[model samples]
Target: MRNVVLGVANTVAAIGFVLFASIVWSAALPLAIGLFLGSLLGPRIVRRAPQTALRRGIALAGLGLAVYLAVEAYG
Candidate 1:
């Protein structure tokens, strides 16, 4: 739940930056669409996912994201 809020906040901020900065939409549109679709389907997925697996998956993804951000910021 908290991660969902953080993800949403990051998404909104990214969208704002993209819109205000006038970045190349063509370069990012596909990735954005895939992410949006994946998130949109999460409810259906959750219905099928086992509780423990879901928690592990989310934790793994969060760790991956943290590492990616750390490298992007300080690597």
Candidate 2:
């Protein structure tokens, strides 16, 4: 029962992430880069740490930098 509940929760979260990414994808390039970098850096920044605030900040910074670079390179 517990496993089933957890699985459902995970599925819901995954769907939400996909939907959010799809919305960002509509912006074309910059947002796609931001999302990609966020997925890559966000985990490392937040891993095995109890500091939620710092993790969020680092993830946001990474996302911003990725978007900026993408726009500068392609735009």
Q: Specify the highest-TM-score model's number.
A: 1
Task: Point out the worst 10-residue segment of candidate 2 by lDDT.
Answer: 19-28
lDDT of 1 by residue, 1-75 (tens): 999999899999998997788777787889889889988998899999999999999999999999999999999
TM-score for candidate 2, residues paired by index: 0.34
How close to the true structure is residue 56 of candidate 1, measured as C-alpha lDDT?
99
Q: What is the lDDT of residue 19 in candidate 1?
A: 75
Clashing pairs in 1: none
- Clash pairs detected, candidate 2: none
C-alpha lDDT of candidate 2 relative to the true structure? 0.84
Q: What is the lDDT of residue 44 in candidate 1?
A: 93
Score residue 14 of candidate 2 by CA lDDT. Answer: 73
User: What TM-score do all the candidates reach, one by one?
Assistant: 0.57, 0.34
**Top-scoring candidate (lDDT):** 1
